[model samples]
Target: MLTELWNQGVRNLVEGRIVLGPGLNVFVGGNGSGKTSLLESCHVLGLGRSFRTHRLARVACSGRTEFAVAGEVQDPHHGRSRVAVEWAGQRRSRLNGQWIDGHWEIVRRLPLVAVHAGSFELLTGPPEERRRLLDWGAFYVDSGFAGEWQTWRRAHEQRNAALREQDGKLAARFETVAAAAGTRLTGMRERFTQRLAGFLCDASTAGLREGLPAQIEVSFRPGWPEAESLLEAYARSRPSDLERGFGQSGPQKADLDIRVAGRPIREASRGEQKRVLNALVVSQGLVQVASGPQGLTPLLLLDDAVAEMDETGLGGIMEAVVSLGWQCLATTVDRGWAQRTAGARPDARMFHVKQGLVTSLD
Candidate 1:
């Protein structure tokens, strides 16, 4: 659980400190009061990225050259530790008051899952989003996944460079390395997806919305022909690869195809998409807890959860979070809604945000 969060020079927030509860914490404020920025800070600190945007520079407050977020986290196995991330000309992270080489170190200490208004993109957006979701789960469950993924990424980059240079020998050499690494990466992803499918199935059976079918199917496309080996696919596509100046077939192109009642979920209504995404994210947290060795419960950051979800949908998501024993931080604009959602829970905490100021109302 995250016990403390401090942010400086982040968006509209010049500086703020929040002490969070172990269960649900709600942030209520009007539009542009920096409610979402607070959630973004936590996402950056935990995942080393933002759910709203990919540009780190954009997160820095106006007229500020740098931004920083620090958290005091208590893990079941690792105990309490101080983790902080700073971004100026470059990004840097520290653990237990000592500087670390990479952001993954901070991420490993504090695992997080986020569902924002745009979370429906996981179902309707591009394949890269789904790939990221899959990889995040694989990274948490499989210790060796990071190294393997990095190796495959490096090899893929090298092969692309070789292709651009028209270096046949070099490209072939790197292709061999890429094929081997991609094969292993794909295998791990397949196994992880299988485990996640079970969780998704259970969530679907439980029903995310009323009158919805329970037949949600998740299929994995390995980015190559199923009948041919990666090596063979690479050889088969080498000419097109050279023309395209990049590797077009491998784990890089993998996608998670989701369908309901034999139709792509993307074609569903907006409300239905939101419900599916909520289930997908919550189920992801459940899968991680069940599969992780440290018994780590992921912290869920939900931005504008009240606005993005209907009452029944929001209630179901909250119920799942509580039942799974995961910590959640949700932002809303309505104080009544916040109170209604959180007031009954003994462990729940609420905060009011106005023009970047945060006041606790527990």
Candidate 2:
């Protein structure tokens, strides 16, 4: 859990710090008051990337060339650890004051599950978003998944190049490696999906929906025909891949087929969609913690996601998240709802943000 967060030159927030409570931390503010920026700062510190925009420059304060987000987290494995991310001409991250070349350590220590305005994209958006959901869970649970993903991506790139160059032998050599790594990636994805399905079907994790749908089935599509081996699929698609100038079938094309009552999620009403999304997000975190990675509890970031929800809806969601035993930081423009939420939980923490300034309301 994130115990302390401090950032400088991040978006509209010019140098702010907050000591976060372990349970539910609510930030109340009007739109554009930098409540979302605070959430984005936590995201950057945890994942080394922003959930808002792809470019780090966009997150920098106006006229500033750099931004930094640092925090102290109560890691299950490492006790208290310091993690920081800074972007000037390039991105740099530090763990406990020692600079690291990549963000892997930070991610391991502080995993994040974010639900923002664009979260609906998980249902309507392209397959990459869904694949990302699977990969995120797989990374935390399966220690070898990251290496296999990297190996497959590298070999796949090489194979695509060979196909473009019209070298059959070279293409075949890289195909062997790509297929091996891709198969392992698919296996890990399959295992993670099975575990997730069990969680989604459980009442404890998915009870927020209150029996919304009869059956919520989530299946994995391994980016190739289920019956065919990766090598066979690659051989069969070689002609098409060569003509298209890139490999067509692999984990890169994977997706999670989510359905409700044997119907696609897109057909569900807006309210139902939100409930399902919430269930999925909550289940994802539960599955991660249950996967047995010691000291690695995911931080939940809600960027006004619960806004406009009715009192019961908001209350149920809050109750569900608080039961997860994970720390959460949620923002909303509804001061009344924030107050009510904080009032109900003696351990809850509250903060107010205005024009990027944050004040603890505890």
Candidate 3:
């Protein structure tokens, strides 16, 4: 869990630091008052990227050329370790004031799960979003999953290039590598999905006030025929691959099917969808805490979470977050929500933001 957070020139947030509580930390202010920016800073420190924007430079405040976010994590065995991200023309990360190779070092120590306004995209958006979420879990639980994922991606790219050149021999070679790695990737994802389903149901039962349907089922689509091995599937799809100048099927096209009751989550009501997304976030955190490496607790970032829900639903989500006993940084425009959440946990902390200034409210 994060013990202290500091940021400079990030979005509209004033250069400042906040001592974070291990349980719940809520930032409250009106829209455009920098509430979300504070949460984004925590996201940056944890993930080395912005949940609101793709370009890191955009996180800089108006007319600023760069931004930096740093934080201290409470390591049970090591005491406290510092992680920082600084971006000007290029990105750099530091661990304990020493330069690190990449953000993965920080990610490994401070994995985070975010549920925001765009979280609904998990259901309404394309397959990549869902796939990304799935891989995040697999990356933490299955040690070999990341290396194999990169290997498969490289082989898949090579196979596509070979097919584009109409080189059957080269394509076949890369296909063998891709198939081997892809098959393993599929297995890991399948197992992670199975675990996610159980956690999702648990989170819904505990987090959603309105409650989910009688049955919640989560399934994985491996992006290929279930009957054929990946190698065989590659051979079967070779014709279409050559015609299109790209591989026709692979794990890159994988998706998740989240069914509430008997129907897809897309068919659910707005309030139901928001609650479901919150539950999914909680479930992902639970999966990580249960299976991740020792002493590494994933942080939860909620930006105006459960926006479509009433007070009852929001309180339910808050209750679930507090119960997790992990670090949570949440934002809200509603003061009531902040107060209620702060009251739920004796260790909870609250901060108010206005015009880029942050003031802690004990």
TM per candidate:
0.97, 0.96, 0.93
- Candidates 1 and 2 compared by TM-score, better number: 1
Alpha carbon lDDT of each predicted model: 0.85, 0.85, 0.83
Tens-digit lDDT track of model 1 for 233-263:
9888888888888888999999999877778
Measured over all alpha carbons after superposition, the RMSD of each candidate to the real structure, in angstroms, is 1.4, 1.6, 2.0
Clash tally, candidates in order: 0, 2, 0
Steric clash pairs (candidate 2) = 76-295, 77-295
Error of 1 at 238 (Å): 1.2
Please report the candidate that would top TM-score against the real structure.
1
Q: What is the per-residue lDDT of model 2 for residues 280-350, given as tens digits with 9 covering 90 to 100?
A: 88888878888856646788988895654555555667878777667889998889878988888888999
lDDT of 3 by residue, 215-236 (tens): 5678999999898899999999
**Model 1 score (lDDT):** 0.85
